[model samples]
Target: MKKWLQFLVLITSITSTSALLASGGIGEGSEGRSSQMPPVMNAKWKAECSGCHMLYHPGLLPERSWKAVMAGLDKHFGESAGLDAATRDEITSFLVLNSADKSANRRSSRINQSIPTNSTPLRVSETRYFISKHDEISASTFKRKSVGSSANCIACHRGAEKGDFSESQVRIPR
Candidate 1:
């Protein structure tokens, strides 16, 4: 009976360890081992949205946020970004599908977790994850001519459009 109990305990330990590793383990902070957002793309979203401003990855926001953003196209950040019904619906679906809540990437998962359940933020800059990460950066830096603003991730993160926000790749413009 003692031998059986010992064997069971050993097996349990090994199984739990294996499961942890398989699920990416208890990674560094909630962001895990990688800060790279998954590569997800939609032609309509890219063209229409990027035509006015930088292309934001869908993984930056949750499904609810995306839904709210989509529903208010006419007043998008105080801009008339209204699109035809078909195009709007397609882009909405694409955004919702790849939103942080649905993305498998660790960084996206962290971003999703940072949001309060009752909150649906339209801007990534408004998320707790973004705030925590940029806590050290001052408002003056964001307002700098070279930096433009916090929303201009591409200004500092060269690979922003590509969904890469790796710490090593960040270069806040002076």
Candidate 2:
């Protein structure tokens, strides 16, 4: 019985330590790991954003960009994506709280660094980091029926919806 108790305690300690490390320390900023997906997700953001297109991770844009996008929902990319006031506020809060500028994740950090301090890009595709990464792809490839456009990340990145865009996992549709 004593031996079993010791073993249980040891297992519990290991599990607790692993979880703590994974959480990036108490009150520390959430950092992105190459092996893991973006950590922030909100149900309203998912439902509302995905209603028209892919549910972009909030960490993809800076807080200012998110604010601008949320404010202009009625004219969202030439379409009316207006949401109820309450819903819009909630989604905007979530996005700003988790925006790339506020994240410590490697990808978010890189994205933030790529943008000029004065610029607030509404589209992730317009960011220097995104453009540099996609510079090799030709325009014709993006126009493919299966690929649609640069905005359609899921067409090439199978795990884009989950915030996993590892190069190894990308398989651009022919």
Candidate 3:
């Protein structure tokens, strides 16, 4: 076999195994939803949480930044958004405690450490990993029903919660 072919096979093997492990398919319990969702910050924060797209933990931002983002929600990214005063406080507190510094998860801290600039989108789809993966996808392919913009997490990634996006899970819509 060619060297490149062998290398590709090796990578495929490792990726498949990792996905299975991450999804807990081996000897583990259920796949959908964890036994306990991470704690919600304030009621307000919980109210505004989104499960799809960038399901980022609020702790990704410093307390001060969260406060700023919450405060500016009225004109948030040129959109109207807001929360009740009480809920705002809850979100602020949650973010403060769980912010990157307090997080044990690598994904949560990765954004803060790597993304040095603050003038970027919050969604993980904008990151280098996401961009490179989708770079070769043709425009026609993107417009198809199977694949939307590069932002659609579930398009190429089947079981993302388990942090697995291998070919085994990929279901490129025909």
Candidate 4:
């Protein structure tokens, strides 16, 4: 009985260790692994959205926020981003289907958790989760020419389009 208990403990230890390593260490989030990438890209969403700015992953916002943004494309962020009915419907459907609330990714889950039940934020940078993750960064850093602004996530997150925002991969520019 004593020997069996010892063997069980050894197996448990090995299993735990292997899981930690495979997951790229504990508490590293879904993007902890360097090779991990975001969900498959929607070609239409990428083309239309990136024409004006960085292509934000739909998993960054909630369904309601995406709906609101889609509904206001004619006045999107002070610019006209209007699209034809069919195109707009396709993009809106894709975004809502993949929104944070529907995602299983840890970062998306965190973003969903940070949102207030009564609030619908169109910008990922305005979420409490975004603010907390960026709390260590100063306003001046975001205003630097290299960074442009907090909205420019690609400045530090090289894999922003791919949805990889691992802390270990961040490289803030001077």
lDDT of 2: 0.85
Query: Weakest 10 consecutive residues, lDDT, candidate 3?
Result: 28-37
- Candidate 2 residue spans exceeding 4 A from truth: 1-37
The TM-score of candidate 3 is: 0.50
Screening candidate 1 with a backbone cut-off below 3 angstroms (N, C-alpha, C), the clashing residue pairs are: none
Model 1, 54-94: lDDT tens digits are 99999889999999999999999999999999999999999
* Best of the two (2, 3) by TM-score: 2
Candidate 2 residue lDDT tens string, 106-136: 7788889999999999999999999999999
Query: TM-scores across all candidates?
Result: 0.80, 0.79, 0.50, 0.80
Where in model 3 is the C-alpha error above 4 Å? 1-43, 51-55, 59-65, 117-174
Per-residue lDDT of 148 in model 3: 67
Pairs in clash, predicted candidate 4:
none
Per lDDT, the best of the predicted structures is 1
lDDT of 4 by residue, 31-102 (tens): 653233356578899999999788788888999999999999999999999999999999999999888888
Provide the overall lDDT of each model, using Cα atoms, as 2-decimal numbers. 0.87, 0.85, 0.56, 0.86
Candidates arranged by TM-score, highest first: 4, 1, 2, 3
RMSD of 3: 8.2
Error of 1 at 146 (Å): 1.7
